[model samples]
Target chain A: MIKVEWFYWLCGAIFIAVAALTFADGTNAKRYGSGAFWGLLGGAFIYSTFVVHKTAPASVLGLAVIMMALLVATGQLGRGDTTGPSRAEQEAGADRFGNRLFVPALTIPVVVIIFAVGLAKIHVGSEPLLEKSSETLIGLGVASIVAVIIGFVMLRPKSPLAPLSEGRRLLEAIGWAAVLPQMLATLGQLFVAAGVGKQVGRLTEHVLPSGSLFGGVLVYCVGMALFTIIMGNAFGAFPIMTAAIGYPVLVQHFHGNAAAVFAIGMLAGFCGTLCTPMAANFNIVPAALLEMKDKYGPIKAQIPTAIPLLACNVALMYFLAF
Target chain B: MLVLLGVLLVVIGFALRLNPLVVVTVAGIVTGFLGHLSVIAILNAFGNGFATSRSVTLFVLVLPVIGLIERFGLQEQGRRLIARLHALTTGRLLVLYLLIRQISSALGLASINGPAALVRPLIYPMAEGAAERRFGRAIPEAMREKVKGYSASADTVGQFFGEDIFVAIGSILLITGFVDTTYHLKLDALNVALWAIPTAICAYAIHGTRLFLLDRRLDRMAEAAGLTTRPDKADAQEAGR
Candidate 1:
């Protein structure tokens, strides 16, 4: 039975390789800090599940992971050299291969879709190819491996390790920002448990006049957009906003269509994504990469679009979600 | 009031520009403790939360593949391919890419044109090249910058509206999880994705027009402040090879 645990073990092994390479990277200034950061995360993954039961004590595991997060958060965890092939090499290869370079790139989603559906029904001697319940996640893991194989066959780099080294280099460049989603999700769960959602519900209820469904939907949509801008991620904002304004007001008070309400609510959040420096990857990074004089250039071009789109989401939810 | 501290911590932390990982960790720990959970219990919540959300970072798997692809010169090939196409202007090129990015993302192929993977290398260069050719010389820095900005926003606009249309994506799953857990409403993912279509269309119309207008701005810049000349090309031209 190919289950989720095996997938984690696979992930744990990859984290180990990341750690080993971090250790081996001689060019990094604070190599030990970088190595320990990845190494400790690798340990957490491997030992937390131990392929089945979590072998590590919760306190020990917690403290160690917390310490590592602290190290990463405090900016102590360093980065390795991220320089890759020079422009000359890149263009030379581009000249040789042309558009065929996309073959390896496109392999990923192709393999993922096939595995996601195919594995569920394929039988092996009166048994399915995968344990049936969580086929999607497992399929994703298998697809990644398949994509790697396709990459090797297509690219045929000078050495097999080229992929791993390049991968590690990119991973290290992303660094502390990489785990922001996981950390934010944890915070979201804590906020829910701490009754923050209830507080937000109360606050929104007081602010909006009672029993106005349109008012409730409008508040909810606008709040979601504004809050996503503040938080920098719509995913992080979704749980809290949904629990607070969305569930209590939009869904229950108005008895709105849950699907339309939440879907449009998240879209509203993306409008915020369009107009914020907080979404650095989308807005700021491109400005920087393009060598724009104004760092907020993307946000400027996007605000007009984001505002109208946000208004459309509000109006759409008010109409469709009912 | 104590429960609200977690919200306060996040706002203040982010506004203060603190490290996000630290801010969130502190918020989680503080909220857990105030909710009367013991330290071990808080840690346990942290552990389980991290464990369960492993799927969130599955993009890590494809990152290496993308890195390898880039290292093998995908971006340059894209640039070269763009240079060969004579009909593309800045506005038209960006709009075309926006469509491609959005449609592919809707199909759950978002990684194909991601910021690091596509925009920085392929999209920026191609857009720059088109703008350079349109202006009859190196475009002014300001115009080039706006072109880059629009290029970047194209990817963002594409994925934002596009991803939700694929019901299996994380945000859709998040909705399924939310509605099920919160309202006891068993909403189908496809329903949410279907409703998302109109909103996606609206986003496309709004952002696509902005991209299209960028061409006029490029023309204005070229006319007013003569194009900046660049020193290169003794290196090698496309057909010269």
Candidate 2:
């Protein structure tokens, strides 16, 4: 009885397919490097899920990380291909689809949200439709399937492989930014696991005006923003700031509303996203993509917006948290 | 202490602009070891964490579909649709998108559009079409760049402010989980979502103003440069080239 997890298998299948495509094409200068990179990751995923060799999972997983590390060390995972459709062809597509093109384009997010957030509390006999926890993650996968189906119906891609190949091209273009969230999050865990948060908390307490609620709130929000600006990710900054200043000072001593504090706290960090180049994905990438004369054009436009938003968030959190 | 050195590793690595993957892996290994996870254990954690959190990139699943759509002319359709609206200006277009993006993101649909997916193909072109309407030819690349900036920022503003309003969003969840686990304080996700409404509105109003004004600025700037809304190919050709 090999109980294979279908989801992992699907993802693993895609990775392996992409790896094969990379190897088959062999057009990119970094073709060998990227092919090996994807192949190893795909192999790790497939083996870990299917083999059910309980003892081997950890070591196998370890090897994948090492493989990735080597790829990074050797600079092997460079992108191979980036050619896309010309303007004439793309315009021709718009003429054909006309107004109907949005049908597929819009399907994904609508389906994702409905499945991710809509069915959270529903019961199917004994168990919930989704696990009470991890509903969002599971639902995201389902929504993707539904969207892909919708795409097939709407676009009627000439062949099934069309979408897979297109997916690979875009995935390669996105490259590391695709898995960035997971990578940064692991760092967050490490920070907490290593008590980085606790130490920051100590330093924060000493520097702050003692017993001042305003001080605490301001410090927490500002700290989160600053840290996120540095880290290039609000999610990464959340654990550290909460540990150092957010949780202990705002949530514990002052007994602020954790929901309001953190909800607004994260928004504050996003203001940093608008202001800093470190958040390349958000600020810099778009600027670079647009080929703006001022490289910081987006940031310049956003500063007025970010500052006002941050101020409002702080005031909102301060008043509401109590 | 020794554990805090992991922070230094991240800071230095990023400052040096090393490949982020390498930097984060090194930081993770150092932190894992310092935190007392064996090397093998750390690897297992990495593998599991990567697998589970892979949900964020589930947008990749949407990419192929998006690619196919783009291949077929979704962006061309977008421009065609925008062209039909005689009065549409660059600012108005961006402002409308900002509202739609924020509202959808509030509904937890941030992935509906992104730089590579939507802006490049659809939104930027529509905005450029509007700019072309005014400049009477191809807009100067500089004005084209401004339009692109506004188009991209709209998505960011919408997502950053709007996503938090969805109670089930990860940021809100992180907050709820932290409070319940550490302080034994139960918080309502709905309350967070509701409070987020005002901020969302404020963001819309604030950025919305800038976007609206951006069109006026573009028009004035174009005029300052002696450009016109009438498509004069001779002048346009010279300026564009």
Best prediction by TM-score = 1
Worst 10 residues of 1 chain A by lDDT: A50-59
Clash pairs detected, candidate 2: A93-B72, A93-B73, A94-B73, B134-B229, B136-B230, B136-B231
Per-residue alpha-carbon lDDT of candidate 1 for residues A1-322, written as tens digits (9 for 90 to 100): 6775677667667667988887788888878888888787767666657412555555666676688788877667887777876778888878777777777656655665566666667888887777654466666677667877887887788988877777787778778766666666556666776788888888877888888888888888888888878977786678778878888788877788888888999899989888888878778887777677899988998898999999999899988888
What digit string (tens of lDDT, one per residue) describes model 2 on residues A1-322? 1111455566667878888888877577787888888787667666655333454465566567567767867878767655766888877777667878777656655664565567777788886776545454455456557767877787777788887887887778876555555565555655666677787777787889998888888887787788777877676677667777777788778887776777788888888888888888888888777777887877877888988888887888888887
Error of 1 at A87 (Å): 1.7
Candidate 2, TM-score vs. the true structure?
A: 0.78
State which candidate has the highest lDDT.
Answer: 1
CA lDDT, candidate 1, residue A316: 95
TM-score, candidate 2, chain B alone: 0.66
The clash count of every prediction, one per candidate, is 0, 6
RMSD of 2: 6.1
Error of 1 at A56 (Å): 6.5
For candidate 1, list the clashing residue pairs, or say none: none
Docking class of 2: acceptable
All candidates: TM-score of chain A: 0.84, 0.82
